[model samples]
Every structure is written in structure tokens, then in C-alpha cells.
Target chain A: MTCKEVTRLISESLDRELPFYQRLSLHAHFHLCIFCKRYARQLLFIRETLRSLSQRIEDPVFSLPPLSEEARESMKRRIREQVLPPDQGNLEQ
Target chain B: MNRKQPIDQHQTSHPEVWVDQHGDYLFRYALLRLQNAELAQDLVQDTFLAALRARHSFTGQSSERTWLVGILKHKIIDYLRRSWRECPVDEIDSSLNSIEEFFDKTGHLRDISHGWTADPGTILEQREFQGILERCLAELPFRTATAFSLREMDGLPAEEICKILGISSGNLHVLLYRARTHLRHCLEIHWFVKIRKD
Candidate 1:
């Protein structure tokens, strides 16, 4: 297979599960082609970086700047108004 | 007053009371994923309303936070569906795009730099680099960004992302490949390139 083809298989390889083959041919190629090997490593690095970045987004901490208190109160107000009947919500207010 | 809630995803009927408990967390989650403050806030608001409307179906098997997140995921999916653009994602013939851009026609490394050789750990630790990365991600097309984030960042499987983003597994892989390629290039230009010049 071409080096370009090997690079695509390299990406497919990183998923680490659901076993996509062509791994043999892909590896055979990188043995001969240092450039494509480096490219494969770089692809893995980028995938690692993106995964690391997502850790923050996935379990996002509350410390990140939030809506202002006024906005929060306003949103609560809007939600309350939507979920509750006007008279009942107003009476509680 | 800010005691951490235990990690039980059991459902609760008091989603109305959840604003004080989960609002900011939800907003932060959406903000990190979507990168739009107003949209995130709106999503938090909308998610609450949706839970209230659908409270009947929420079996209390999961924790309140888990249940709310379930609703929130639906909102995110709906947003992705509504916002996805057509062919710029799929129809551009990216088959040759990577080969031409990164590798020479003879498949040798050309002018393109696999040159971002900085420590990935150190680079991730840099807050400014992270900010730059987020901005670069925001620059990606809507569906491309969503598919990439859901898979790489959020640690989702390809099949699930395909279902959520409404695309085939093949399309999902293509988008992910392109997203990684674009992000690597963008990070190099913004982060490594700047570091090298400095």
C-alpha cells in the first residue's frame, strides 16, 4: 500500500478498540518510511492532546466564570414563570 | 455551603429545585462544549424546562444530576442537528486533501511541518495554549467540531457519535480525521509557531 494509505490506517489504528485490521500492511509500510512513521506519531500526539482537553470539558468545574448573579436570578425567574402558573409563581415572589 | 453532592444518578422529581444545585454546572458543561456563553445559559434554561415537561417519564433509577444530563444531552443533539451545514463537511473530496496537503504526491514529507515537537504535556498545561486551542476548535465547522469533541474530548464511541450527530460511521471517521488534521495545523500555527518565533 502507498504511504498515504498507511497514514489513514494509522489513524484508524488509534481508536484502540473495535479492531480494524490492515495493521500488518500499515506497519510493514512504516518500517520502510520514516516520514510516514513520524506522521503517525504526530497524529497520535494530536489525538492525545484533544482527549486531554476534553477532560476539563467533560467534568467541567464550577469555578469557570458563570453567568452574573443578576442573570442567574433572571433565568430562575424566567424558568419559574414558565414552570409555574403566573398567579402562584407571583404569589410566591 | 458548597458541599459536594454524592455521585448517585438516581432520578428526582424536584428538577425545579435543581437550578440552585445543577445550573452553573450545566452551564459550564455546555459552555466548554459549545464555547458560547449565551447559548450555554439558554441551554441550561431550556434543559430545566424540558425536564419539567418530561418529568413523567423520568424513572427515578438515576441520580438527579444524571437525569438532568440525559435531558441536556438531548438538547445538545437537537442543537447539533439543527445547526449542521450540508456538503462542506462530506462532499469536498477530502480523500486527496490530506495526501496533497501534508504529504507530497510521491508520499514524501514536503514543506508541511510535523514540526510541533514540544512536549504535549507541557503544552496542555499552558492556559494560554488551551485558550488558543479552544478558539481554534471554535473555528471548525459546526458538525465537524461536534463530532470531534464528542469522540475525542468527551470520550465517546464512534457508533454513538454517529447516532447523535446523524451520520454514518464512515462519515464520522472522515470528520474526525479532518478535525484532528485541522486542529494539529491550527495548534502548530498558534501555539508552536509562536513559541518558535519567540
Candidate 2:
């Protein structure tokens, strides 16, 4: 495959696994082609950053503002009712 | 004393414990995607209620946090999916312009010769780095950001994201590609490049 084809495949590979021979050729191309190597590294950088950021963002105590005291009480009350809350409140754009 | 309950009777503990133990985490998780305090809190409420209803399915295979996060993820997706359908599909974002510029007439990268002086991906672990990442994510177009979050952060299947975003498989690929490339450029310029230069 040409460099252009391999680069596009790199994005597709993120969604699903690449084909076996295609994976082999892409890996082979990485060694022989500087642009493909750089392209692959950039994608990896994005994935790694996202994964780590996702992990930290979800930490039980990662330091984003906690739910307010009143919000907590309101939440507990709603949960205790054991019914889905009304959809009066919509997500802000 | 771990007594296994039937799937229908899978009650583990009172629901209030969930508020104390998980309310904050779930709120932040939702806020990261929704970026709205009210919606985030509301989604956490919905997740807790849903957990109560499906308590029987709490098989104890995962940590409570993990279980709660799973429920929260679904609530966010369902919420976003509904909202996405209500709103018109956004105009194509300018974020793709730089990506187009990266390639030449033929699809080869215009200039991809150099690599990072060091792999800056690890810097994302820092709290400040995470803040920067969130800002970058917030800058993306609504559907672009949602498509990215559903796929990358929530780890939803591409097919699932396609359904939620009301996009085709081909469109989903391009959307995800646009999101990642845009974010990469953002983080590169805002954090990586700034830090490396300094």
C-alpha cells in the first residue's frame, strides 16, 4: 500500500482491528517510511493522552468540584423515590 | 458474608450509600461529557435510579464504582443520543480544515517527517494536563465532541456511536478521525508545543 493508503488505514484501525496482512504491511511500512512512522506516533499520542485523561477525569477524588451539599440531598431524595425523574430539566447546549 | 442473590433480587445495599460513595464520581464523569452541572447531576440521579431498578443484575463481578460507571455511561449516551436527534446535525466544522491541509494531492502527509522530542502523551496524567485536555475537548463542535467521547472515553462500539450520532459507518469514521486530529492539534499547540518550547 502507498503511504496515503496506510495513513488512512491507521484511523480505521482505531475503530476496528486491521486485517492481518494489512497490519503486517502497515508495520512494515512504518519501518521503511518516515511519514507513516510519524503519522502512527501522532495517533498513539492522541490515544494515550485520551486514555490517561479519561482515567484521571473519572477519579473519585480527582479534584473537580464536588456535587454541592444541596444537590447531594436532592439526588438522594430522587433516588429513594425509586422512579426516574421527570425530564423537565434539559441538558444545556 | 457474601450471599449471592438471584439476578432479580440482586439488591446489595441501600441506595443512599451510592450517593455518599459514588455521587461525586458519577457527577464528574457526566460533567466531563455533558459539561453542564445540572445535566451531570441529573444523569447521576438517573443512573442511581436505574441501578435500583436493575439491582438484581448487580452480579458483584465488578467493583461498585465500576458498576456505577457502567450505568452512568449508558445514561449519558441515551441522553446524548436523544438530544442529538432533536437538534439538527451541526454544520461541518472547520476542525477538518487542518486535516485536509496535512495531505497533498495524493493522500500522503504533506510533512510528517519529524517525531516528538519525547512522547508527550504521558503528560496527560497530570491534573493540569487533564484540565487542558478538557478545554480542548470542549472546543470541538457538539456532535464532533460527542462522537469522540462516546467512542474514545466511554469506549462505546463504533456501531453504537453511529446509531447514537445518527451517522453512517463511513460518516462515523470521518467524524472520529476529525475529532482525534483536531484534539491532537489542540493539545499539541496548547500544551505540548508550549511546554516543549519552554
Candidate 3:
């Protein structure tokens, strides 16, 4: 494959979406081509690094703060106010 | 542990309860992708509001966590659509060229795979890396950045991305290719080269 063909296929190859024959052809080209090899390495590095970054972002500590009792009650009250009409306050009795 | 049971049961029983319980997780998830705290907070709020409004649609095919995340995903896409406009196709080539120059000047095209580490535990703990990533993300055109973040950071599939962005598969591939290429160059410049120097 020419450099242009290999270049065009780099994204698909990294995505693992290329057919087996296409993958083989790309691999063979990458082995013979210094630029394509560098491209593959860079792509791999970027993918791994971004994946790691995302995992850290999902850490439990980074999640929302736990609801304190006051906050929880406030949220409940807000929900009730939205769901209940003002005239219904006396109907519960 | 027993004291937590009622809370768990309440969350399981009502979607609103679940949102109150997991709003922070959803916010952080959106924030990482949006890279804007205010937008992320809004997306989380919209997600919960939509979930509460559509609770009857819940079919139990997935766990509550997955259900909440699904709603959040849609909310994010909606937010992206409203806030992000496409760059003219004419601008793509110039942006791509600039990115190439950025990489070249930073000497990131050189090899340092021997010293490169793939561990997120180490990489994310560093403030410099985070700052670099934020800068890199800022350099991207809005739509490309959003698409890339949704696919990579949010783990959404390309097909879903296409549906969300209303683009053809080919267009989505192109957008993703451009985004990834830019990010790869930036990461090399900001992280890899700096690490070698250190």
C-alpha cells in the first residue's frame, strides 16, 4: 500500500474496525514504513492516555458530594412543592 | 450499613430519589466531557429533570445506574447541539496544518516510547498533565472537540455519535479522525516531550 492509503486507513486500523485482510495489509505497510509506524504508536499512546484520564475522572471521590440530611430534606421539600398544589396541603389530613 | 438500607430502597423505588443520590456522579461525568463546569452542571440538571419527567419510560432493561447514565448521555448530546456549532469545512485544513506545526515545534514527533507509561493512576494525579490536556482541548474547534469528547471520554459508540450529531457515518469518521489527530499531536507535545525533558 502507498503512504496515502496507509495514512487514510490509520484511523480505521486504530478503531479495530478494519477487515482482517485490510488489517494485514496495514500492518505490513506499517512494518516497512517508518512514518506509519510512528503514526500507529502516536495513536496508541493518545488512546491509552485519554482512556486513563477518563477513568480518573470517574473516580468515586470526584463524584457528587453525598447528600447531607439538610440537603436531602430540602430536595424532598422542593419535590413536594412541585408535585403538590398549594390547595392540597389541607387535603392530606 | 443497616441505616443505609432505607435510603437505598428509596433510591431504587423512585427515579427522583436516584437523581438526588447520583446527581454528582452524573455531573462529574458530563463535566469531564464538556470541560465546562457550568454546562456540565446544567446537563446534569437537565438529565434529572428529563428522567423525572419520563419515569414511565423506564423498562428495567438496564440497571438504575445505566438508566440514569443513558438519560445523562442524551442530555449531553442535546446540550452539545444547542451550544456547539460546526466549523466551516474550509477551515479544517488550516487547523490541521497548525496542529502539525504545533507538534513539530514542540519536537513531539521524536520517539520516547521507552519512557512512556500508560497508567492512568500516575498520569491523572499530575497537575501539569491536566493543565496541558485542558489547553489541548481548548485548541480544538467546538464541534470536533465535543464529538471526540463524547466518543472517547464518554465511551459512546460511533453509531450513537452519528445519531446524536445528525451526521453521516463518513462525516463522523472524519470528525473523529481530525479530533484524534489533533489530540494525539497535542498530547505528544504537552505530555510526552515534557516527560522526556524531566
Candidate 4:
């Protein structure tokens, strides 16, 4: 397989299982091809970066603006209305 | 001989505390997926309300955040489905075509001769690297980003992603391929290549 074809296969390999013959040739190409090998490694790295980032503990550094105070108050109010008795005023714990 | 303190089920399940506990996290999850603050906020609000109504079904199997996120995920998919018809499939195709510039007529790579200098572990630790990655992800077509995020970020399977994105399995593969190619290219231009120069 050519470099272009092998690289596409490498990308697809991440998402799905490839046929054995295709996988065999892809590895064979990787043996002789430094460029496609680097390509595959870099793509794998990108995938890892995203996966880990998703699982990482919420860091303020990765900040998207949090819910505003007003929004929070309103959301709490709405939730309280549903859970608390209708006549029960705001209860603080 | 000590007795465990009796905790009120109502107190444990109260949705107001949920607002304080999971609200920001859920908001950020929705914001990343939807990219609209108002809509994200609304979805988080809706998720809490939905959770409250469904409180009795809380099996305690998953963490509270996970359960809430599951609810938000459905909401996000519903929003995407509503907008799916307007998604420009041709635009996504043109973007993939741009990636072909990396290859020659003989199907050989043009200029990616050297490996990246920074190690993946080190790069993953850098906050700035993530910032650049988020920017690259934002550059992708909406549906392409949705497929990539569901698969890569959320660790969802392609079959599941296809269902959520309302695409076929083959189309999901194409979207994933496009996502990886575009993100790699974008990072090369914006981050990796720049690091090489410096």
C-alpha cells in the first residue's frame, strides 16, 4: 500500500477493526515507512490528549465560564419549587 | 457500640444541592458540546429539572454527575438532531479535500519527513497544548466535531455515536477520519510546526 492509503487505514484502525489482510499490509508498510509511522503516532497522541482531557478533574485553568450567580439562584429556586412543599419557603441548610 | 447517623433520603436527593454540586460541571459539558452559553445554561437547568422528576429511578449505580451527564447527553443529541438537516455535508467534504494537499500524485507524503519533537506525555501535561487542541477542534465542521468528541472525548463507541449524530456507521468512519486529519494538520500549522521553528 502507498503512504496515503496506509495513513487512511491507520486512521480508520483507531475507530474500527480492520480486515486482517489490510492490517497485515498496513503494518508491513509501517515497517518500511517512517513518514506514515510518524503520522500514525501523532494521530494517536492527539486522540490520547483528547481522551485524557475529557477525564481530567475539572481544572479552573480549562475554564469555560461557570454558571452565573443569578442563574444558579434561579436554578436552585426552580428545583426547590419542585422538591419542597409549595408553601415551604426557601430552606437553607 | 455506635449507630450510624440517619440521613434523610430527601436531603441526599435534593436538587438544590445538585445545583451547587454538579451545575458548573454540567454547564461546561453542555457548553463544550453546544458552544452556546445561553443554550448550555438552559440545558443544565433542564437536566436538573428532569433529574428531579426522575429521582425515584435513581438506581445509585452511577455517580450523580454521570447520571446527570447522561441526561444532558440526550438533550445535546436532541439539539443536534434538530439542526442536523441544515448541516452542510458538502462543506465537510471540501474540508477533507483540503487534507489531500498533504499527499502527492503517487500517494506519497509531501513534507512530513520528521517526527514531532515534543513527547506525547509531556505535551499532554501542558495546559497550553489543550488550549490549542480545543481551538483546532472548534475549527472542524459541527457534525465532524460532534462525531469526534463523542468518540474521542466521551469515549463513546462509533455505533453509539452514529445513533446520536443520526449518521450511518460508514459516515461515522468518514467523520472520524476527517476529524483526525484536520486536527493533526491544524496542530502542525499552529503548534507543532511552530515549536520546531523555536
Candidate 5:
């Protein structure tokens, strides 16, 4: 396979999303091509790095502070007013 | 002062029930995609508000959670498009320096088949790697970034992403291709050139 083909398949290969024949072709190319091998390694590294980074940032303390009770109530009130018309002011039916 | 009622219990068949239940999760999901808490919160709120207005269109084929997420995904794309139009394309640092330096200086790549061990301790301590990945994501074109974030971060299926983005599967693949290629190149430059210099 050409470098362009290898490049296009790198992400799919890393994700294991490519079809069997495509995977075999990529494996064949990588086995013979040092550049493609390095490229595959780099792609793998990128995937690994992103996966780890996502895990680290997965649970950041909600950078914005929690909505205050007043703010929450105000938002609820606004939503209620918008959804419930004047005649249906009492949302509970 | 009157006690505040729970948002979920609010009686109208409004979509707020969905938000009340899933808002925080949606916010977290959007924050991961947008990397801006305020924007994430707004996106979640907009998702619910829009869903409420168009509640009729929901056919109930999928779970409500999935439907809301689908809506939120579109909101994210719209937000990205608006923001992209507002801002000029500028070069941002997209280096793989930290990972490269660690590999070159310490040769850890040989020891670990995966550059990162699955251990939580090692992963959390790699702050530079996290920063680089975030920077790399930011460098992606707006649509490509949205598609990758939806697929990778949100774990949405390709078909769902196509429906939400109103793009063909071929278009979706193209966007995903661009996103992944840009990320790979960014990582390579970070490792090969940036880290070697350091």
C-alpha cells in the first residue's frame, strides 16, 4: 500500500475499526515499510495519549461553580413560565 | 421562604424532566467537547429548551436520554460553527513533546507496549500530555472537531452522528479522517521535533 493509504488507515487500524482485508493489507504494508511502521507507532501513541488525557480530565470539578439555589429556582421558574401558559400557570395537572 | 420543588417533578410534559435528570451528565459531556464550562452549560440548557419546543418531533423510537443527547450534539455543532465564523484561524501549538521526551530520554516506549500504563496514578500525573492533547483538539477544524468529539468523547455511533450532523456517512468519515490525521501529525511533531529539542 502507498504511504497515503497507510496514512488514511492509521486511525482505523488503531481503533480496530477497519475490515479484515484492510487490516491485513495495512499489516503487510507496515511489515515491509519502516516509514509506515513509525507512522503506525506515532498514531498508536496519539490514541494512547488522548485516551489517557481524557481519563485524567474526565471528572474535573465542574469548572463553573454549582448553580446557587436562587439561580436554580429562577431558571426553573423561567422554564415553567415559558412552557406553562397563563391559563395553565399551575403546571401540575 | 417556600421550599423549591424538584425540577423533575415539575408537572408539565416539558423536556425539563430530561434535563433535570441528565443535565449534569450532558454538561460534563459537552464540557469535554467544548472545554469551556460556561459554553457546556449553555449547550445543555439550549438542548433541553429546544427539545421542549420541538417535543412533538420525538417519535420515542430511542430512549429519551439518547434523543436529548442527539439534540445536544447538534447544538454543539451549531455553537462551533458560530464560534468558528467569529474567530480567525490561527496556528496553535500541537506538539507531542512530553510523550516524545519521555520516550527518548527514558526509552519508556520499549518497556510499555502502550505509551501509558492503565494505572490511574501514572495517567493522572502526566499533566503535560493532557495539555498537549487538549491543544491538539483545539487545532482541529470546527466540524471535524465536533465530529471527533461526538464519536470519541461521547461514544456516539457513526449512524447517530451522521443523523445529528445532517451529513452523509461518507462526509462523516471524511471529517473523522481529517480530525484523526491532524491529531496524529500533531502528536508526531510533539514527539519527534519538539521533544528532541528539549
Candidate 6:
């Protein structure tokens, strides 16, 4: 297999299981080509960084800003309007 | 009844309280995936509304935050499905053109020496690394970014992503390939090269 096809396979392998023959070719190419091997390593590293960043995206420690107060108020108001009796929703205002 | 009714029917499932407790986290989650503040806010609100309607079915198998995030995830995917359908075909085709540029006539990669010397631990800890990563993601087209986020960041399976993006599994694979290739190339130039120089 060409290096280009092998590299695309490498990326696809990360997301799904590769067929046995395709896997054989990929490993063969990796054995013969150091560049494709290093490219695989680098792509996996990128995936790892992304996974870590995903965790931090959820964690408040990463410094991602929260929803604005106005957005919060609007959301709450909209939720209240759905759950509350119409007359009651207006009463809170 | 002349008196207004309290919004919270049950203490644990109070929708308004969800807004206070889980609102920002959900917002950031959606914002990172959707890459739109207003749309993220809209999806968060949609999640709360959906949760309020489906509150009766939420059997407390998980924390309220987990339940809310689950709902918000669906909302985001549904939005992506709609928007992706509306995307012009040329946009997707043009994105594919750039992926080909990564290779030369012999089908070997153009940059054989692309180096990523930093260890994963060191890279993850640096605030600057995170900034560069986001910048790279933002450079991708909407479809590719959404596909990558759903697969890598959100950890959705290939089948589910295909369903959400309304594409076949083959198309999904190509989209993900493009995402990984573009992101790696961008970070190599912007982050890894700069670090090596320093």
C-alpha cells in the first residue's frame, strides 16, 4: 500500500476497527517506513491531547468562561414559563 | 388557585435549580462542541426544557447533572444534523481538496519530518498548548470540526456520528481523516515548531 493510503487507514483505525487484511498492510507499511510509523505516533498523541482537553473543557479548572448572567436569567425565565402556570409566571416578574 | 405555584415539583429535579447548578458546565460543553455562544445557550435551554418535559422518566439512575448533560448532548447532535443538511455540497468538496495537498504525486506525505517532540504529559499541562489546540480546531470547516468533536472529544461511536451527521460510514471516515490530518498539520507548524525553536 502507498504511504498516503496507509496514513488514511491509520486515522480511520483510531475511530473504527480495521479489516484484518488492511491491518496487515498497515503494519507492513509501518515496518518498512519510519515516516508513516512516526506519523501514526504523532496522530495518536494529538488524539491524547484532545481527550485531555475534553476533560478540562468540562472541568472548571481550565478557565473556560461560564454562561453569562443574562443568559442564565433568560434560561431560568424560559424554564419557569414552561413549568409555571401562565398567571404565576407573570407574578414572579 | 390565586396563589402562584412553585416551579419545583420535586426537590431533587427542580429545573430552575438545574440552571443554577449545571448551567455553566453544560454551556461550556456545548460551546466547545458547537463553537457558538448563542447556539450553545439555546441548546442548554432546550436541554432544560426537554428535561422538564421528561423529568418524570428521569429515575435518578445518575446525578442530575449527568442526566442534564445527556439531554443536552442529544440536542446538540440534532442541531448538527439539521445544519449539516443545509450545508452546501461544494463546501465539503473544497475541504477534501486541501486534504489531497498533504501528499505529493507519489502518495507519500509532504512533511516527512513533522516532529512532535513534547511528551503528552508536558503538552497537556501547558495552558498555551490548549490555546493552540483550540485555534487549530477553529480553523477546520464546520462539518469537519463537528465530526471531529463528536468522535474524539465527545467519544461518540462511528455509527452514531454517521447517523447524526446524516452521512454514510465511508463519508464519516473521510471527514475524520481530514480532521486529524488538518489538526496535526496545523499544530505541528504553530505549536511544535515554535516549541522546538525555543
Q: In terms of lDDT, which candidate is stronger, 2 or 3?
A: 2
Candidate 2: residue B23 Cα off by (Å) = 0.6
Tens-digit lDDT track of model 6 for A4-77 = 88889999999889999999989889889998998899888988877777777655446567999999999899
lDDT of each: 0.68, 0.74, 0.64, 0.78, 0.60, 0.82
Query: Each model's RMSD to truth, in Å?
Result: 6.0, 7.3, 5.9, 4.6, 7.9, 3.4
Q: Give lDDT tens digits, candidate 5, residues B85-179.
A: 56443411132222233233432222222232234335335556556666777777566677787777655688877776666777677667667
**lDDT tens readout by residue for model 4, A1-93:** 778778888988998899999999988998898889999988888877776666653665565678899999999999978876621322321
* Span of 10 residues, lowest total lDDT, candidate 1 chain B: B1-10
Cα error of candidate 2 at position B99, Å: 3.1
DockQ of each model vs. true complex = 0.35, 0.32, 0.29, 0.50, 0.24, 0.53
DockQ, candidate 3, comes to 0.29
Q: What is candidate 5's lDDT per residue for A1-93, written digit by digit as tens? A: 556556667655543388888888888986876666765665555555445544444355223234344534544665676676632434343
Model 1, B1-198: lDDT tens digits are 124332222445444468778887787778777878888888888888888767657777787788888788778767866776443655334332443586667765453555567676557777787788777887776666777778776778777877776778777776777776676667766776678777
> 3 or 5, which is superior by lDDT?
3
Best by DockQ: 6
- Provide the TM-score of chain A alone for each candidate, in the order shown: 0.59, 0.56, 0.55, 0.75, 0.53, 0.71
For residues A21-79, what per-residue lDDT tens digits would candidate 2 score against the true structure?
A: 98998999888888787777887777766666567765543557789999899878877
Q: Once model 2 is optimally superposed onto the true structure by TM-score, how far is the C-alpha of residue B43 displaced, in angstroms?
A: 0.5
Ranking by TM-score: 6, 4, 2, 1, 3, 5
| Docking quality (DockQ) of candidate 2 | 0.32
Candidate 2 structure quality by residue, lDDT tens digits, B1-198: 124323333446667788998888888888877878998988888888888777767888897789999889878878888887876655456434546766687777665445655444456446677688778887787777788888777778898778767789888887777777677666667776667667
TM-score of 1: 0.74
Give the lowest summed-lDDT range of ten residues in model 6 chain B. B4-13
For the predicted complex of model 1, DockQ is: 0.35
Docking class of 2: acceptable
Model 4 Cα shift for residue B84 (angstroms): 2.2
Recovered share of real interface contacts in candidate 1: 0.37
Off by over 4 Å in 2: A1-6, A19-33, A58-63, A80-93, B1-10, B56-62, B94-98, B103-114, B117-122, B163-166
DockQ-based ranking: 6, 4, 1, 2, 3, 5
